[model samples]
Target chain A: MAFENYVNSNESYTSNQFYEKLLREIPDLIFQFKIEKDNTYSMPFVSNSAMEIYGFEKDFLEHDAGPVITDRILKEDVKAFLKSVLKSRDTLTRWNHEYRVLLPKKGVRWLKGSAKPEAMKDGSVVFYGRITDITANKEQELRLVLSEKRFEFALEASMGGVWDWNLVDNTVFYSEQSMKILDLDETEGINSFENCISKVHPDDQKEYLSDIDLHLKGITDVYENLHRVKGRKGTYKWILDRGKVIERDKSGKPLRIIGTHTDISSQKEREDELKKTLDIVSEQNSRLLNFAHIVSHNLRSHAGNFTMLLDLVDDIQDSSEREETLQHLRTISNDLTQTIEHLNELVSIHTEIKIARENLNLYEFFQRTLNVLSEKINKHDVKIISLIPDDIHINYNPAYLESILLNFTTNAIKYSNPERRLEITYQLTYEKGKKVLTISDNGLGIDLEKYKDSLFGMYKTFHQHPDSRGIGLFITKNQVEAMGGKIEVKSKVGEGTAFKIYFNEKV
Target chain B: MKKFNDVFVVDDDKVYHFILKNLLKKNNIEVNSRFFENGHDAIEGLKENSKNGTTLPDLILLDINMPVMDGWQFLEEFRKIKGTLNKETVIYMVSSSNSPFDLNKAKDFPNEIQDYFLKPVCLEDICRIFLN
Candidate 1:
């Protein structure tokens, strides 16, 4: 009977040894803990894999697990680990934690630990849990958070907008700066793709949609365009939308897109205005070239005629006929002199007034001009009223300003009505940092509809006056423009005329 | 100066031609001088002379400004009329354009233009051209 009992008992002991061998062969880091009185902890079992995870012998933990907690757990995480364990002790459920743990040979590692409660018939709790080293994954997540913060700061400081799109969900992700660029509040309702399209200018809506579609179809890797968007102030702003399709799946379907928006309204406006100014200047230059040709041909012809006439007088022998020829020649010579003088004056005006710029006192300049033309003003029975301020000033060529003022005042007097008493008034007004001077006259006003186009052209005389050479206004216009100023005229047939001059105010 | 059978004055202004013709006569140039209102008529007269085998103008006073064709255009067309008269004919371009551009252009035409004279071509200028 003793021999039979020894064989059965030995077989049972062999089966138990096989069970323990099977548990040790598993790859996971397994452990068993036993709860004691006074909230102390003990490990009844620990797998050999604990050596690989904690860099310690499994026997050390199994011998005295309470000391292992303090030795292995980092100094900073020890308190929290104890508190978590104590809080979950009464729950009779699994408790888990992620904390930094120090190893005997390894420096430090990120570890996850858990424990489950087991109830015995004696009301004592026992637990089992596993520990994992997740140091690489934790480092990767930390680096990603830092890079995102840097990108957000850069975008906000540059006043740029960043956006991302999820192709699978058909949803868009916008940074805080992206909302600001759209002139929307941070708390405003989320914008759908259709809402973004509606804000684009009507002329650009089709192009905007088509570009996105092309990008989505994987036909293009990038899309960029300039479009007008309504701002918070309800005014249109020009923005450059540039984006790249970053990801595509195996079947060539777009997965994600990233882009930025930059405000370029000021630059676009400057380009447009520059093109317009260039066109105007080109047209004016061509007209001047044509005028120069006509001037050369006409002037030379008259001079040639005069010279030939004088030569004929010298060839005549009879004294009586010679004297008569000389008399006619004198008349032609006088006309030629006047024409040449007019031409010389026009040329001088173009060259001389182009070089000089100085600060000018309007009050003094106007007074001097009036003094020079006092005779004509009196002869025309004109009442001159000056409304210039003493402190007003402008940057201009002194001689040009004098010439312009003289011509305007003289013209007002010359074109005055014979039966009516002429009243010429000068008024200066400052608006929005620009100086405006208006010279109004009660005179025989011009029919602007008929002569407006040629009013400031050389040799363009509309009135039937003996002294209307038509050069004064032309020179005035050139002088004004050369000084960075402009002139505008308003008139009616019989009522009156007003000349408004706009000039930059002296700071 | 050698006298010739005829002279031609081509210009638009009647006063210029009248004065030039009388001056030529007073200087005792002793030549039959004719006047044309413009370069077109003057060229026609020259063509008629060439056909008749008569001597062309001993000296042609060419004015630059005229109604139909000017002195420069006439010179271009005159070169095409291949005749014995061309070797003997002398041409003077008279203009009132005091621009150096015009003077430089005149000098560029090597053989067609004989000389350039400014406005008021007086007796002294004419005398100098012939004497030189």
Candidate 2:
């Protein structure tokens, strides 16, 4: 009734005057509607802006909205428009609704309507309201929603999830992908620093903590850690974690640390497998080298026999000596033929012995070796005084050490002073970061001044012993060098001889 | 008259001693000779014979590859006692190995190994040293 009073009395001017004033003063579409007792509604005042908004003639909207407005309202929003009108009809309250309209040439447009309702004494209702073109705001809102969805899709494709740890609040947020990488349920999971640390393998925790500390101290620009974290399946998985302090407070305290985690378990396993394969290849190479040495040695022995028989056949004098020489020559020929047959089958002298370097318990090894040579030692009454300490360990190949010790011990025994009990002393010490092993013996000492050059030569003998094939020292020297060590000798004619081996550890 | 008074043949190969003794006999060298099995036996014999002031060899032929003691090992101990010896003994180093390495090694011992002889020593190889 109050809105009707304004509509009926305040209309000092005619309906055309009020609408003409509205067209000049107002930029929005304005309207006034009155319903008759017969339930027919007519818009008494529909401004000229309606012609601009709906692209229709001003006379076209002056009729009851039953055909014009109802047909123009979007099909989907027609109920919302009707609901607002019905609420305004009974309650006599304000009507406000946003809806869409399909116009003649302007296509679809968005509009907002607001009106105050009044009841007339003639059992009719009147409404004075305004409709706004809100298409720009709605389009901008739709664009924002579309861009957000595109960003989320891109993140999912990258398998990347943002994570932020609020250092100040001691709280953590793991995005869906990040939670899934940590083996935590992506939909429902909370990852705090304590839980993350607990998931990390205990052995890697110290290194992880140290790296984080370095990053926190600003020593590193970013925190990087390659470590293993226990998964839901209870197996540890390797993770390549990279993070940086994304935000800091005024006092330079870290406010947030954001990062990403990549599952690198398969890559780490591949590296380990490659290393094992390399080890196998190296072992095979060593076996092949040993086979080559033995083959050469066999060839040389055969060649030596051939030359010896050739000499015997070249000279024959008396009939008795000729018969004997021919017989010996025939036997040597048979031996050489057998050696040639051996050449067809490649023989590895020490193929089964893989060179493994580790800390060697010298005392235990020395005792084991002494037992092996105990028979000869006891026969010769040799005293092997091991000056090496029980705790002295050397980084050397086990087989090389065994061969070197055996050669030195045997050489000492063979050249022992026949007039006295043989005395051999062995000791080990570190010299300039290299192990120096000295094996000295009070035996028939070598005349170093005369035979020093040929001491380590093949088939070069320094002492006259029946069993001296003159190959031991040469092979011993080779074994020492193959293990990255060097051998040297010092001797005095009547005093003694000492063989020293210098071994350096590989880093 | 024979060129040499006595000959010492030190070798592990019985064939060398037999062949050398036969060649010397065939040539009517009329030289007294002693056959030692290896360098050690020869060294000890020479030491004992020299200490007793007995006649030592005028010419010595030593094989390089003999068991118990090699020719090189004998030369080492030979040098130390050579000054105390009574006789002036000419030395020759012989080996079956014709390797250039062994030849070069023999060249180093001018006083001890006067000539290096390879095996299959025809009488000519020995005749060149004494008859020449």
Candidate 3:
């Protein structure tokens, strides 16, 4: 009677309602298998969903499921999966393995199979297993691992370090390479934010903290700053720290930050050295311009004088006055010879002589120069008015000072209008550690607009005077610049001219 | 040779003027040789002569470099004076400058300048003027 009842219940469970409920309950194909003699397997039951998984009818797999399993299991992964299962059976433990399976009428797919061992009362071992398709998940995991390897190679090649921060836990995670960059042992724990902060220079600590705070407050999505950090060798190195907030909370608050650090000390040093070299080149260029002006002026004046005298000698005749003419000729020739010697001396002035800085009395020097030109001033009916203070002095080269003053005085006399009496005035002032000397004249002034560029050029003459050689101002400009001074002119066509010279004050 | 109403020597150098005046007297140039220290003085004299309808110089020996104004500036101003002085009067540019630039510039004023002479004007050079 009990055997009849079991058969009757199985018949009722196979009804359409019962089968429909079973298909809905288990969307995956379900099967029950029983082991036979010598490596053969038998299936007593198979669900209708088996058609969806293996593209076969349930009746075909009802007696034998081994054919489907063997046929669908990829040739390469079958041996490994079988070996794992056998080993797990000997140990009487569960088995888990991921293997590729070739589906009928479908491409190959990866499946994760897990089997549980059941102990029977007859001392026989039986196994039940479920296979879940994990093809997409396995491919994604492989791609992630490859990308990580590429990032590691790139970081190493670029000499960069990677870091990650956990905002909620206040911990920092540094990669092995990052630890190496900080000169720290890779095995040491760098799991706390304090460990990273401790390596930063004291001066940069505030800035580094502010950058992190700004990122956390959602002020910015990225933080970049340069800071010096103490390396494992206790040497300070310049590092460019760049990071972006990667993980954010629902409120758009940054939960985690990750970034890189690169050493840029050598590049920074090269940039600073290049700037210093450029400054020196510009300074030398200014000096070269002043030197060129001096050469053009001095050389052309002597040449002009020589040419004029030679032309005059060719036009003269009469033996009676020939001797007197020869004497005048000798005087002019001597002047030319002296001018050439002066030019040679001026050229040698650039031979790196150390300048002797000393205090110089302006009034005393002015008086001395005035005395030297007194006879000419008297003959020309000229008056000199000095406004310089007696105690006021400047640090300068004495010879340069004398030359500047002499040139100005002679120029004033030479260009003076014959109809009016000549008057020259000198004034001195001090400002911002600089001494300024202003020499003004009531003689014929220069047209600054038209001749400003050529005023100090060689052989440049604006006045139609016979004595104009256009060298005095040129030499004066050179002397001033050689002594670390600067000169400027202000003049109009008929009004007089004023030369303002500035010099560094002595300590 | 044709006699000129007036002759002029415009030069900055005094020795050139002295030699030129003596040469003119020896040749009996039959003209009053006027001397000017510079182009400025020479221009003033020419302007005054033009205004008064006085006889203009038949010939002018002008120097290039002079005080206040140069021979080139004198010629520019001399052209503006509207009188019967054109075509009949001849001007000679005498310069000590051997610059080819100056020679080319003189060629531009061919109507005003009859000839260009280098320094140390000699009798033979003056004779060329009479032949022209």
Best by lDDT: 2
lDDT of 3 by residue, A1-507 (tens): 001211234355535456557555765655554444344555555556666665666467434666677678889888997788667666878878889887766688777867676655655456766566677899898899999899888898878988888888978777777777677775544567887788899999999999878877878768988888898778898888889988988998678889998888897789889997786456445534543543433334334434544544555566755565566456545645655654564554455365666788988999999899889988998888899999987888787788778888888887787778888999997757688989888888887786686566533432223235455676667667656677888987667889888875442
Write the residue-wise lDDT of candidate 1 on A303-419 in tens digits: 655666665766577898788677657755765565566567666755663456688898899999888888887777789898998887877778777877888888888778777
The TM-scores of all predictions, comma-separated, are 0.54, 0.41, 0.50
- Candidate 2 residues lying further than 4 Å off, grouped into runs, are A1-361, A387-395, A432-434, A462-470, A505-507, B1-5, B12-15, B18-32, B37-58, B64-91, B97-115, B123-132
Model 1 clashes, total count:
1
Clashing pairs in 3: A297-A458
Candidate 1 ranges with C-alpha deviation above 4 Å: A1-27, A38-41, A57-66, A90-93, A118-125, A162-176, A184-194, A206-210, A217-219, A246-258, A264-400, A406-433, A437-500, B1-132
Cα RMSD of predicted structure 3: 14.6
Full ranking by lDDT: 2, 1, 3
Please report, as a value between 0 and 1, the fraction of native contacts recovered by candidate 3: 0.00
Interface RMSD of 3: 7.5
Poorly placed runs, candidate 3 (over 4 Å): A1-319, A338-358, A379-381, A417-421, A458-469, A504-507, B1-6, B18-32, B51-55, B82-87, B98-110, B114-132
Q: Whose TM-score is higher: candidate 2's or candidate 3's? A: 3
Candidates' chain B TM-scores in the order shown = 0.82, 0.92, 0.86
Candidate 3 docking DockQ: 0.05
Provide per-model DockQ scores.
Answer: 0.15, 0.05, 0.05
lDDT of 2 by residue, B3-52 (tens): 67888889765645555665666677778789987889999989998988
How much is B14 displaced in model 1, in angstroms? 19
